[model samples]
Target chain A: MNKHLTVALDAMGGDEAPAIVVHGAEIARERFPEARFLFFGRESEIKPLLDASPALAQVSTLIHTDDVVSSEDKPARALRRGRKSSMALAIEAVKAGDADVAVSAGNTGALMALAKFILRTLPSIDRPALASLLPTYKGECVMLDLGANVECDASNLVEFSVMGAAFARTVLGLQRPKLSLLNIGVEELKGNEEVKEAAEILRNSDLPLEFAGFIEGDMIGAGSADVVVTDGFTGNVALKTAEGTARLIGSLVRDAFQSSTRAKLGYLMARRGLDGLRSHLDPNNHNGAVMLGLNGLVVKSHGGASISGFATAIGVAIDMARHNLIHLITQDLGGVFMGQSVEDEAPLSNPDKEASSR
Target chain B: MNKHLTVALDAMGGDEAPAIVVHGAEIARERFPEARFLFFGRESEIKPLLDASPALAQVSTLIHTDDVVSSEDKPARALRRGRKSSMALAIEAVKAGDADVAVSAGNTGALMALAKFILRTLPSIDRPALASLLPTYKGECVMLDLGANVECDASNLVEFSVMGAAFARTVLGLQRPKLSLLNIGVEELKGNEEVKEAAEILRNSDLPLEFAGFIEGDMIGAGSADVVVTDGFTGNVALKTAEGTARLIGSLVRDAFQSSTRAKLGYLMARRGLDGLRSHLDPNNHNGAVMLGLNGLVVKSHGGASISGFATAIGVAIDMARHNLIHLITQDLGGVFMGQSVEDEAPLSNPDKEASSR
Candidate 1:
């Protein structure tokens, strides 16, 4: 058995709510036998689901919370009114050092707001950006600031690069990850001032990262870098567009195979190969968005994710906590900050600052 | 036969040079029997290719030029020193009323700089944006500012929406195309200041375009809107990411089919369906990117595009010329401008003005 790592869960969050949340925890518990869980939500709803999974019930403690934050609630309103809500309480467990990490399948804006407010950011970190694992031709790559900050300046981008590198090292297990700035073109003269400036800084930085220079969006799926950094606006759009394209192609492929009787028979013959392809591209297999630069580790799973997907998200949080991701990130950021003591002070109201309020 | 439309070709541009340009024009000649061509390049190189196609030679005039803008040349350098280059002459042909449109497969930055200098912007237009046809669930949609201007304000986005609508009407043959601002989220509170402002303006505009409100990037391939508008940086990233995702899936599908003998046999049986999918996703089928908001039409073909791809680009130019796209764009802008006369005077130098110089 391994060291016990407690994970706080927002039981009332997500589309499926306490049912999938408790069932996913059961699946996770079987995978990680030493892990313990704290389920926060209405006891009446969660007790029944938790009771169904005796294995998870054995290692879990139920904490009742009547208040639940709706998906439609704004971040600011959620922060003000959701102090004792299920989502807030889970994050508070991490803040109080009662849990190693917090995992939620809830509203993204509400989760971010509560986590930031309760846990606060690291001393050297200005803002926390969302980082997630993306499958690529080579294997997997990490992309940051997915939708956390809309308009990032050069410094904010530089910070994202630092945080992204740390997250890649912890999650992807790369000793020296190559980082690249996302832009329209690879040329130094291309893109806006912020992209160009961030490129220059990364190119000359004294950090341990291998700066791969500017990489266009097309190069992302090619696995040109271990870490891809961009402002939240562009990163979010690129990420979503890729997902939409994948879905479109998947549906089109299915339609083609079902178009005729011969095609259907062919699909049956190729079922094994198709299964492999599906397993490789399945969203449930890779389902976690790590909130980096925070004092404690917090993972936001997709609200509409199935039990399997939620389990995968818990797996991600377990890995991050085991590897001490928060400590590693803080150390990396401290080194970068010390190396650039001569530069101007970090901006108080950077891109991510506006994101919380918006 | 349709009315004869003259198209000036930059014979020295593209990876394949005069060979692909001359050959593609021949293919276009077969499709559009009334089209005339003006080939600008070295007389020695282009003469042989032109002679090889007796039909294209019959309706074509070869204009010799010693200077050829290299693909490596920067936009500013190209603009200053490529006055007599093949690319420059092609745009000049349109400005001189010798050709209805110009088409090239050259350095994008160089083409934009030279075309903007030679053709100039329309009286009501502040900048020219690159608009192209993207395949979606519902046929195809038009996306603008692929890489023309980076940092767009609300005004720039509004102008892009107008231009995109006009382009869709002319090229996609839509009566009242549904337009939407490309954003991180569909909510009014999502994204940055510029996106919110643009959505507000588009929602209240008196133009004929159907303002479909905000659309997230993931909704792009779902055919949610006929025209998607955004700043150059985000649009460029999203477009390229979609292309990359398509390529990734294509390679993965091939790998899956080749993994086993049964899969290979299945692929053979499903050849008819696979072929349909192949033809649908072929880049050559959707080739040209029209530079809109300029006084004259200029289409940019992919640098590494095949002969068929180049032909598709020529077809796009011919369509734009036949429909008088420039006039329709001017009329659309006039409507939006008249409607917003009560607001502050339009800035002389918007985001695109800085892009040209940078």
Candidate 2:
């Protein structure tokens, strides 16, 4: 999608870091050999993994960086101590205009914070949120602020709507992403004051999203709206709950398949159909979480993401680089809401209601 | 659960009222022959359903009433008109000490309005809310304020948590139910100002609940906590979404079973298992929405619920009477918190934003 180009990879991050990360990078590289890969992390840790397979050594470059940022480190501390940190260095590559886009499967908060701190946000952009694609019965549903900003206001929600639409258009490659506010209730008068106010603002805002009125929790998996935008709080709950339920359903289906000889026989007959369903709901196919509304692109992979997840995140980064997603969001939000250019938008305080997760 | 019961049934309330309502009364009558039933509405319409069956001999009385309340009536308007409505007549029967409890599968707003306006709220209660038992992997979870109140404060949430715990224990026969606040995120400071303040109040105040801390959306069906509490805004979302998803999953499974000859054989062999799962997740099993904190028991059934659902609502009402639930919640809240007993606690409003429903 990015026309085969280079991407800055964070090798010393995530649960299965360096190994799974390196393996995923290799898988991605083999598929698109023209795309150059810059691996910035501890060379000692990553080199062996790459050397174990000659194919990975071909398209990937191992940058010598000795520091590693633990997921437990606070975003501010990580960035401050991370000038030499692999994560910070990888992000710095994009900020310094070296790497086209920076990608990581590490701490999301740290990634968003460093991306905003280093590369900065576009005009009228207060915070940059990680918007990810959720696979549903009706294909993929785009949800933003998965864990980015928690205490988001009406204005911040409006910004998310704008940014989410742009991401859906560019990365998701949708014509006009249908947008809906994620509220506790579908009624206009319901929810905390923030949601009611956001509904009014989005109703009048110039964002090109097809303002599909409101979508409730039921409609989320039902596919009522193509792109559902909300503060990080509701978004994270919906995303995690849906993922958990999907996983639970998968487990139950597996149990059913093994419960009896007859079910096992049916499963054997419909192996292809069952496999199709499994692949459709696979987390690996929809892995990358983009930090939307920033001047430079940054994508966070699932920390516990598998190899397929890693490859998907890399492809997402490559795609964003080619499309210049930030430029598009900047231009759109700047012209419509703040009357400034994308590059000129000042950084507003991220209205993140930090969840219990690290 | 109540060995012998008398229930005032608003036969003219729901979409299939008079028919399904009468049918449910008959079914319930069949089980409990001594259970007194009052059919309040048009006598002409109900006499036929009763006369056309062998169950008519057990029909206690046909209390002819001319008024009918539509589902669209706002609570305030419904309260004014309910004076002459069939639903109001039913409540009056409870007030007159004729029936132990009043059950309606009609307008939710009307039922709540009449219950509060006629039966009034418990002294220690604020607003009455619809609390229901939802399906769970563990068993059943008691969740409250599904749609009663919209704009709630922290104090209200604390109260809901208390009321939810008490109802589950007294009626559902749960012992020391673990309580949780339904939040977008589980962090102490993750929710809006109301939730944030409520979390503080719950942390300090005395209530009968176990106070398990904040639980998220997807956690509802997962049986994360025994009792989940939120304002009606969020509770309604969780309830409706779960109901809708259950319906979706049920239909999908049914279709999957009928997809092919092998699938049909699998379905036949596992028919009991599939039926058990269906009944386990059946909305009819969870048919009534209780308006808790009221002076008198008020339970709302699904408008589209059939005979089974209505019968379940009646059973809930009977169970409430048997347990003396209103007294228990008040005593539980007061004994745990402050001021005399919980029965002495329902002041209707707290400055910290604690109202029962909204």
Candidate 3:
């Protein structure tokens, strides 16, 4: 029996695809000698990296797919029309029991739409949300629904709070993560009706979550909450604003270092501290977008990501798989069903059927 | 001949209150010996700062005002019943021809309402707006309607653009200030209906504003626009978020410094750079809130300001007075009414009549 960890890698995706995707698979095979990659893209594009993999030197079974997904393709339409797209085929690898997880850097919307159509959301989840870890002053904080679902209802936000809390615990190893509803203000009735209602629901919820009050964009980096949930519009804006601000601040620091001769010397002497700041603010250390709440594991890397960035994302998927995070989330969602009947329980996709079928 | 430059300061306003207010008045008096300030509050509270000010040894006429407005007081209610409040009386001092400027660190809404009600807005301006200078990565950006009006029409935003442009020229010395309407996205038709329509109006307007297009919240600090205009709610949230972010970032740096001995030494070495940042982000230096579209001068300090903060706001008032900023703004506003009839061109205020009355 081969002790292999197989990953279905979407080769024809992202800003620099086939190259970085195949390169990342090659790097991972080096770490896990028994690891196998089922590359999903055209043979002409991925043949170089596939041929370079020592284990696949003479193996015809190594490259499992030869399809490509175009980023410009409309998500829902692409899912229906492009059944053999690289992303679609990669996702199918999980369904066919040929891969432990599927990974992509393709159009996020297409991935999410196709994933839902192919894999099907767990029993209780209406939609699979994207969860990403943010670098906070206190280690890290997890935020969800990054840009998955823009228009959200109060119940959706409440469900996000539950899902995000579970994610932080599984990923960051935090116990009973502090959760907050992201809003412009902290008052109970501060936001739109949905948000205000969500606040009320969270307050009354006994989901084992530390119901921290509303966390503003500024307090996001200050450890106000271990987990934060908001509609995709606000969350995406906040995330991009934070990213843009960090870059702006980093650039400003560089300018300040060269502003005056004295300041330059001052910065030189304090190079260690400044370097620490630069490291702290760098997004690479905290890079990769995680798409959670799906039936199977999937991670989205940045379009301009390098092989190393893809490797980090692959590592995240491996860790998430090792812990059976999505399944664990299904089980832990018990907290949210405390007073509710079976009908009110959030849906969960059973992984046991997937395992037995595999 | 007495060169009494009467100033009515809200003595019972802000957290620091009479202490900072009195200290600032004393400093202003010492700095400009010819200037006289009539502190408005109950005589009992005003007497102590008066006793402290050697220059104000003769403190006889105190207007007998006894009320003080609290932050929790509603804006409209404060404007109504606060007729006897210290801030109300302070503005009344100007209306009564006993003061040149009225400054307060009370509730911003109440200040704008009272300021507009008492001193009146400049002709052709329907609503008065609060403007503040924000620190941009490249330079300074001035924004209007910080919290004065929650909902603004396209015309109001346009007027804000004109007033802000004049303000940047006079206060920041920017010749042709670039103006941007804050929006959800950069596209002309992307933002809210108001913003989309505002962009159209601005694109077609004859105002001398260098309408640079829509700007997001993140770019506000990048000097993307020399002047930014938005509804009060979003603008206030952005302002507060920026202030809070700076504070949060500073705290994070302080903690990073104490993390290890190496970090401590690095921090000590970088103390100068850090200090530069501290001063750079200081709200004190960036204090003074401009009540634009006003006939005379009204400056509202942050409700949480210290004595030095109140003093800084008064300094802005003094500068505006010296520069005849209101008259200049009214004169320059001719651009907005360029092709209007001769009767429409209004002189800001007849200097000869003003002097004779004085």
Model 3 TM-score is: 0.76
Q: Each candidate's fnat, in order?
A: 0.67, 0.22, 0.14
Per-residue lDDT tens digits for candidate 1, residues B1-358, read: 5678999999999999989999999899999998999999999999998888888899999999999987777777787799999999999999999999999998787888888888888866766788999988767999988887877889888888899998888877898999999887676777788889999988887877899998888788989999999888888889889888888888888888999999998988887997888777777888888999788999999887899999999999999999999998888778778745433323433332334211
Put down candidate 3 lDDT per residue, B221-300, tens digits, no spaces.
77789998886655665666566556656666666567667666655655676677667667777788888887778788
List model 2 lDDT by residue over B1-358, tens digit each: 5455678889898888889888887777766655888779998888888788756546567899888887656556666666878899998988888887889887665677677778877666666778988776677888887777766777677778878989888866777788888775564545567777878888886666677888877676677889988877556655655654554454455556667776677666655544566676678888888888777877788887878988888877777877788888878766755653334434333211221121
Give per-residue CA lDDT, model 3, range A203-247, as digits (tens). 887777789877666677777889988866456545655655565
lDDT of 1 at B258: 93
Selected candidate, larger TM-score, 2 vs 3: 2
How would you class the docking of model 1?
medium
Best-fitting candidate, measured by TM-score?
1
Residue A233 displacement in candidate 2 (angstroms): 1.9
**Least accurate 10 contiguous residues by lDDT in model 3 chain B:** B349-358
How do the candidates rank by lDDT, highest first?
1, 2, 3
Residue lDDT tens for model 2, A118-196: 8887757776777888765666778887878756778778778888898888866787889898764454544566777
